[model samples]
Target: MNQKLLMAIYFYPRGGSSQVVRYLYQRLEKKWSSALYSGSLGNKGLLTNAETFYRPLNVKSLDYTTAHTAWQKGTNPFDTENPMQASLEDRINVPDTLMARLSPEQLAKQIQSWRHLFSKELLEPALAHLHHLTPMHNAVYELWKKTKIITHLHGTELKMIEYIRSNPKLPFGDWWIEKMIENANMSNLIITVSPHDRDLALELLSVPKHKVITIPNGVDIEIFKPTTLPDKVKMSYWKHWLVTDPQGWKPNHNPGTIRYTENDLKEFYNDDGSCAPILLFVGRFTTFKRINVLLDAYSIFKSHSKQNAPLIIWGGFPGEWEGEHPYEFARKRSIDGVFFSGWRGHDDLPLGLTSSNIFVAPSVREPFGQTYLEAMACALPVIATSTGGPASFINTEPGKKTGWLVNPDDPYSLANALQEAVEDQNLRETAGQNARDYIERMYSWDNIAEQFTSTYQYVLSHK
Candidate 1:
């Protein structure tokens, strides 16, 4: 048998791309033998992935020793044997006088700032810059000079933009593009998760088009399978009941509750024992996510339709961001159909997906949306914006296609799609089934992993 495909994924821990990185890790670990050789600011990426997936065996956090001078005196937080520690010690050699020149507090502050700055998102560009700026730090010039190890750049581009956006006068702006090119050359293979990103990487970084591969992100099909939901869930039906309440059901849902269990669900149903359809919005609660526009569209949709408004299962609760709550905004506007579900993880996400008639992704700038893929895999139809990464997958063929694509920023477009999806149950079910079939053929984790494995083999053989 061929040797195991030993690969290292260079990633940023808490950034937007971690979801995709974790998905890649989950898929690859199922088949080929793999380990996460992580470098981060505060080992944040490793910790974040750990919390999200919470799997520890495959992970190897490698914080650089020279990343902090204290490490030379033995106070580094990372494992001593980490690859980064070796590179750090070997590269950053301050003169004895120079080291003793600074006060302890000044030295500590400098190291602390450096430690905080190395996010996974920025690691690629920083590594790429270091490769050109100080050739001794280049992994390609050192470790890969003889070893047959394969290195892949996963979520670097997003961070480069962040660095550039935040620091215009960032060092090496003159050679930044060239350094990025060198880093791209260092990778045995580059697997970009979206078509738009693939194009952007090749164009901006000067990576050869043929060297980059675009693999649309995938979902865990087995885990996200549709469940047999009850015909009458005995939940409240206020918003959606106004339109299609043939059962003459009264509203039974209470918006103020910590958890809604089966007994509570039954008791919450109307006197006639029937409930209305629920709409769902799941993802991070942030401004770029466009939750405000969704509320506005929901208000408009409810006002126009004579049917009772649908109950919304909005996940992604906001932390103390000081921004006004979008649900509260909808409520103030007399939009009474939203039931916020806070944030649910892997196991509960599928059940939540199946519980809704439609999944709406209205992000104004979504880099890559794993939630859309998850929703589709759960046999739930989607109404996503026509821009961003989700645009690549949410094809708009109306009745036969997987789901509807709309202008995420436009209230009318979202309203139109929402109305279309809710008007006909057959349309919703058909799109939902098609979505499930599409996910199985294209976006299942097993298939994605196999594709990656093949890419690894090809890159190792050819490079």
Candidate 2:
């Protein structure tokens, strides 16, 4: 019989950690009897509802929809029956208020909610794999102290801590950071996505070197791999996503608040009437993502870009933003070629990557860029920065690279890279194929699942 295992995370299906849990559970389900405990944000039928996102898995969720709704109605989300979990970033207009901003009472509620989340499924599993260093970990320790736990840091927690270190007096950040360290110290093992992150975890969590492991995320190649859609089909998808069903939102507004006109589709073509090279960017509107810098670079590229070459910015979780909104930034600068796809489903991401000619997201120090790998799998040559997770993987070598690498946060460097990429179809096609090849050899989910199998085996055997 398969040994029982429990995996948990504090967030619902809103971010990378959620997908990591789902993908791992999908693969590990073959060898381990597993159940998921996640903090959820909506009713039963919605994607934020953990049961729905992790459907068919034995699931137990702490619904935050009521709490989130309360926040929407101008009440404190944290004071509701199920308080919204705090986030790594202190986002405005979102239920995930910054962790540092949480008051002492709110912090206790965060831990208690999570402590109670596993009230039933403290299912006596042989091992428990918990994602992040959230208050959830504190709760897990109290409830399942005997069950060996492996803590996985997806990078945001580290970022938040880094911010706290710089601003040590920032509210209750120091207290929370100490708890995160305590959680990390208690775990049997700590997992990070990139070598850089692995090293960072050691410094931030103050854990022994033996306790940390680096495991890059995996991609579902079957869904994300390169495809050649017919011309009409491509046009139909573009029109449908941009004109017919936009999800882009403005400050205080929800999805579909920034829909485009049907005439907007004309921007995808050159004056000569041929399809233009599409530059795609996908990520949330956080400061580190450098969407502002991308707009600056795209403006430089468009100044001389012969083809209309529209840059499609593909995600901005409605009403939630960390800095000058990318939309507002673009407006102030009078940049005309930028488009927003807003936030769409993960299944649609592959389609978006495949639809574009080149992919670029100049995130400074991404923990582990799963989207970059997914873009590579879709055969799109990417443009990444030399600073973070993508640096560890993307090769910009003359003959071997999957994509181009520009200096982080430098608009001129990115503009030059974008110009070179958009102008040469031959270069893009070659790099695209190389990207696909690299992902097949290095990032497939099956291959990654095997790594987890070995790691889990090691943890169990030592236990």
Candidate 3:
């Protein structure tokens, strides 16, 4: 087996890309000796703390904790000794600079910082599995020219490149665009999270088709599998998340800005014995996520349906957003049922999914919906858009349908799907069962790992 060095320039469990790194490594360990070099932030115990999250593994991190502290101290975090890497998406306040916003000098700092990180590590792995396209790409090229590389695109980079290409005059647009292509060409193998993403890699990066391969992110069935939670226990969890120890954030504020009262818990369940069906949406509040659509649909669904259900909006990193905050959007519309759970660790996801009856996210162009699989594994009927990653796998056929795939960006379609899911509990139950079955048969981590193993071998031999 080939020795491997898995590298991602992001903190663990931040998003699906990070989750992919964790799950893939666990699966890869039996076949290869691997070391993880990831970007980390926060103190030792937090999820941003890489050593805590990727424990019991050989892990080294480029600590961004200092940069975070610098930001808190009202200094330029980007000018700190260990600067945070620029993000693909443009975000409001917080540490890291956006790639589009990065000046030539600032861009050089990012590459220099990553190079310093690479030099400090005693990494001698036979191959490097690098995640996302960044200044780290240039850093690697500068340090280890002969190192075998497998460049993994989690879909965000492609989206960023697309946005930059559309508006050609965007700052450093030409430079970054050409840089990504050069970075991609240097790789021996390119792995994408979905086939749709693979196509984008070919067109956007202008890399050869043979160089690009689609390997979808996997679901950890052991953790995400369905288990019916008792109402009292479910209510306790919801109370902790929504009322006590709340993390629900608002625009220009830290988490817990959108806390709920004890009386507000009534929306989670009806007066009758049966629990009020929870409509769950889990992801970052990026522009493409189209969370506004979910809020609109939820409002419409509540307006029509006598049986009310609360829409639990979960999972966005604190103080990071693309547009108007979801809380702000729901607030302006006087949306009553929508509740923000803020961002929680991966362990909370299974419980959240099992407690909710329907998993709804109307993302316009979701790269590959990792949360959808996690929700499916928990046996919840999912309502996703008809475009992008969800469209590729969400089968709505007569006997094999697992979830409802509505037209993207259309609130009414989502509202109708939401209505249908809540009303038809029997069909919902069947779909949930089907969703779990599909994940078990198709998207397990072990299966995805096998694909990576074979792909890795081919690259090694050719190189």
Local distance difference test scores for all models: 0.54, 0.85, 0.84
In angstroms, the error of model 2 at 425 is 0.4
- Superposed Cα deviation of residue 203, candidate 2 (Å): 1.4
Itemize residue pairs with steric clashes in candidate 1: 12-120, 13-45, 236-253, 239-308, 239-309, 240-309, 242-308, 243-307, 243-308
lDDT of 3 by residue, 56-75 (tens): 66677888888888888989
Model 1: how far residue 145 lies from native, Å: 3.2
Find the candidate with the highest TM-score and give its number: 2
TM-score of each: 0.67, 0.96, 0.95
Q: Candidate 2: which pairs clash?
A: none
RMSD of each: 10.6, 1.7, 1.8
Whichever of 1 and 2 has more lDDT, that candidate is 2
lDDT of 2 by residue, 315-371 (tens): 887677877999989988999988888998877888888788899999999998888
* Model 3 clashing residue pairs (backbone): none
